[model samples]
Target: MSPARSDRTRRPVDLRQRSTMAGEASAAEAEVEMALDAPPDPQAAAFFDVDNTVIQGASIFHFARGLHRRKFFTTRDLASAAWKQLLFRVVGSEDPEHVAEARASALAFIKGHTVAEVEALGEEIFDEAMAARVWPGTKALAQLHLDQGQRVWLVTAAPVELASIIARRLGLTGALGTVAEHEDGVYTGRLVGEMLHGPAKAEAVLALATRESLDLSRCTAYSDSINDLPMLSLVGEAVAINPDARLRAHARDAGWRIRDYRTGRKAAWAGVRLGAAAGAVAGAAAVGAALRRKR
Candidate 1:
């Protein structure tokens, strides 16, 4: 086997072992209990990817927009992030550079900020920017799992704080997300580990399964990106929701279930619509300026 493939295969085991040793596995289970009052489903659970799978767009982008509106960052920063967001929306996949840039920017802004402060703002941001963006179909699927007495968790590359807020609002069991380290209630501008993404996501699921006493053969996972193949493959049942081209093709080859919520027209016009919206905003601003000059 190629070295890269070999490493990918072994990484999950390493991560699972480390997380169990660090007590994070048990902590993840505790978070689920604290977040929900439902009866335990020790043998099965569901994992959902957050970005395009559960919501209409990238969750972190919306959170960043909210932070910009709150004056947490400059307009130049927002413009840069907006470009990346546009690319993600158009391409429907993660870009490593864009992800790194976003992580660095987020950490920079939250440095020295209290955890409570960020969590409080995350709550407001979710209400303002994220709640309305949730895909009704995806929400229904999650609800279906909940109805079946299975614990549902969101696995995303977004910060744990934001991910948890989404879970609580959606009435899910909990979430697994990239953890930014903090000390004495304040952010240290460093992550506890790598972002909960790709293989890392699979590792998290494995650790959580071990802690929660869940059977991998009974668990299901849903996602939109091919990057999540590790996580999806680790589970017994995998569903692709609004998947990108690569994932759609892979799912077909693998015989996994696929669900596309976007109409053909909607998918084709997504980038055009975003461009038109930006033009409209600029036109409105110009018209307002003209009126002010007349006054």
Candidate 2:
């Protein structure tokens, strides 16, 4: 099935608009007009964070890798993105600077590309890289919401086109994500507002809720990172799935439902093994340099 067409109206909500109640309300009404064919439950819906919550890794990182393979960017750009992905995996959260850099890089790469072109590539990339990476446990949770007649929307920091593809492929309601500004069907290489992250996520959810006439107290939200606290806090039921250290602690204190799919010992051992491998590679490089110097 083709991805849901939310990106057609996926414009970013300005944070400054929240200063006035009238402005905020108007912005909410204008921002979200998701073309979800699913009949919403009216009172409730579920919002899920994409990275590490619904998927095993960062969706945008995977998408970037796919784009790099498609000759969208250079090897150096991919290396930089890979490093950011590694940091995200190790730390289990996002850094503002890293997010900004990624946003800038993404815009630079897609400048002048038509929205249709990117969306088409996104479909292929999703099948190639994102489909297999979805967490079954989290997928089940999203399915449960669907079974209960609630709309399940993937709220992510990834581009709305990619997020919408994942949502459609997974047979969910729709998605809300970062909006890249485009004009006359081509990318302008600029953002409408800011990336859909941190507090901005909460704002998007609020706007979406207003647009869809959803009750915040009846809604549920799931996420893995502490960066999504604002979003998690906005809902009536907050679930922490494979939560980071900070989010786990906060979830415990707040009495939120915590679901960890990863085996703690196994994950720790994997990290140790990765560190050991890096050390070994460094040692080999050092030995090679010493031998060359002696020669």
Best by TM-score: 1
Q: Model 2, stretches more than 4 Å misplaced?
A: 1-40, 81-103, 264-295
Q: Which residue segments of model 1 deviate by more than 4 Å?
A: 1-30, 34-40, 81-106, 265-295
In model 1, residue pairs whose N, Cα or C atoms come closer than 3 Å (at least 3 residues apart or on different chains), thus clashing, are none
What is candidate 2's lDDT per residue for 151-243, written digit by digit as tens? 888887666777788988998878887676778988776766665666667878887787778999999999987878988999999999987
* TM-score, cand. 2: 0.74
Judged by whole-model lDDT over C-alpha atoms, candidate 1 comes out at 0.68
Give the range where candidate 1 is weakest over 10 consecutive residues by summed lDDT: 280-289
lDDT of 2 at 287: 18
